[model samples]
Target: MPGNLIHFRRRVRSVKNIQQITRAMKLVAASKLKRAQDRIIAARPYANRMLSVLNSMARRIDPAQHPLLAQRDRERVMLVVVTGDRGLCGSFNSNIIRSAMNFIEDEAANRTLSLTLVGRRGVEWFKTRPWQVRHEFVNIMTRVDHRYAREIGKGIIDYFSASELDAVYLVYNEFKSVVRQDVILEPLLPIRRLEFEQESDTDPGVDYIYEQPPREMLDFLLPRHVETQIFRAMLESEAAEHGARMTAMDAATRNAKEMIDQLTLTMNRIRQASITTEIIEIVSGADALEG
Candidate 1:
């Protein structure tokens, strides 16, 4: 009984320690979630405005006039898969990876697809696969900035423009809310027409003149647009990862607390049973002695 009590007490202590660790992890995840969410929110306006400007510019330019806007007989495709570097965030990474795999499988026989992975998770996932990896950018999830995105964007644009890759696609998790994230695949090159819902349109009776030329402005804007899109995706993925981690850690903490409570209850029950047994034994001994 003494041995059982000691063992049960140890188990209770172990669970309590795990509960503390889980609580700490939950707090840390909460802090990171706030910062990541703030960053995503702050970047939304800039990304949206950039998209609006690009849409306006793309509407004015003839698709045949711009190489980036020209659709080719794509024999080679480049997939830029974005995921988190770390994997404690529930199914965030798995969702993106699975979507990416599906995408690759869909494009496998149709076109020769090359990979440009943005996170360690994606890189590790594709390393053993029989596909080709053109480029990989690890540790980008730690701190996603415009510079990192621009560098990646520039390389991809250069390759695609040089006809190394005929088409480019990006896959990432889009942050919807704290509890929801959607896997998204967006075409990166060959700027497509912006589709919006039908609505009664009001025309501003004002026309603006271009300084240099529409083609030149598009030449500069298209690459920037791609960079902005990638940056926005990175931000969304980051925020979603943090949100998932926060939720997962919070659940883990709660589960740990519940487990500790159950263990403690069991320990207390065992101790009480031991006490009852000892009392019964003592009473039996006294009765025998009296007899």
Candidate 2:
């Protein structure tokens, strides 16, 4: 009984230590999440405006002239898989890896699809797979910025221009809220123009004076638009990563507390039972002496 009590106390102390670590991690993640959320929110307006401008320009320009806008028979496909660098987040990395694998399996039947992994988690998960990995970028989540996005965007653009890959796709977590992040598998290449629904109250036609030819504007705008999309995805994934870590740490801390409570309760029960037994033994000895 004493041994069990000692073990329980030790376990309680271990759990308390774990609880403190998890609480600290939770607080750190929360702080980072706030900054990430602010950045993503601020970037949204610029990204949306860029897309709108791209759509307007794409409608006027011929697809044949622009390499990005041209449609091609997808002989080869590239999947840019985004995940977190570290673990301990509930299912954040697993969910993305699973989704990407499913997609790769599906696409393997028809197209020769390759992977471009971002973050150590995805890289480690897919490194053993049979699929060809064109690029693997690890430790990228720690410092995500427009320059990183631009570099990735430029590489894909160059690949497309060189006719190495016919199509490109992006798979990442899209942050909806602090608690909700949905896996997004979206096509990123051949630059499809999104059609907007005309509002009844809006003007029939709106015109803008162009400083340059629409084709020239599109030549410049299209690449930047792709970069913007990549940048936005990076931001969303960063925020989602922080949110997931925060939630996971919070849950871990709570579980540790619960374990400590249960252990303490068990220790108390054992101690009480030992005391009662000792008292009974002492009373029996006294009675035996009297006899």
Candidate 3:
């Protein structure tokens, strides 16, 4: 009984220590989530308007005039897969990897598939697989920035322009809320003009007066549009990862606390039983002496 009490005390102490770590991690993750969420909120509007304008412009112009508007056979394809660099965030990494694999498998049936892995988790997983990894951006999530996205987006644009890649797609976790994240697969290249018409908030019937030729405007805007898209995706993934970590750590901390409470209760019961036994033994000794 005494040993059990001692063991329970040690267990409770260990759980309390673990709970403290988890609580600290939860707080850190929540702080990061807030910052990431703010960044995403600020970035989305500009990106959306720019994309709307570009798409609107693309529809009015000739496809031959702009490389980005060129629609080609998807015989060769690349997927920019985004994942978290670290783990312990529940199913965040696994869900991304699973979705990517499924997409690769489906695409492999009809065309060539390659991956441009972003984040360490993606790099590690794809490197061990049979798929071809075209590019890698390790630890990019540590600091999500437009410059890093621009570099990556430029490479992708170059490949598409050179006819090395016919199509490019992006796969990532879209942050919807603190408790919900959605896996999103978005087509990046061959800008389908019609898709944007549905998403546009502006009047589709209206036209814009351009200072430069539409072709020249496209030359400048198309590349930057792609970069903006990549940046937005990075921001979304970072925010989602932080949310997942925050939620997971909070649950862990709560579980640890529950465990500590149960252990403490058991220890108290054992201690109470030991005291009762001692009291009974003393009473019997007194009776025997009196008799």
**Candidate-wise lDDT, in order:** 0.85, 0.87, 0.89
**Best prediction by lDDT:** 3
Which candidate has the highest TM-score of all?
Answer: 2
| lDDT winner between candidates 1 and 2 | 2
Q: Could you tell me which residue pairs clash in candidate 2?
A: none
Model 2 CA deviation exceeding 4 Å by range: 194-210, 213-216
**Candidate 3 TM-score, C-alpha based:** 0.90
Query: Mind giving the per-residue lDDT tens digits that candidate 2 earns over 1-291?
Result: 999999999999999999999999999999999999999999999988987766765555567777888778988999999999999888999999999989988988989999888889999998787999988888888889788888889988988888898999999998889988999998888777555466336533344457987568766877898899989888999999999999999999999989998999999999999999999999999999999
Better of 1 and 2 by TM-score: 2
**For every model shown, what is its TM-score relative to the native structure?**
0.90, 0.93, 0.90
lDDT of 1 at 291: 100
lDDT of 1 by residue, 173-233 (tens): 9888988889999888867665444432663322347796867877887888889999999
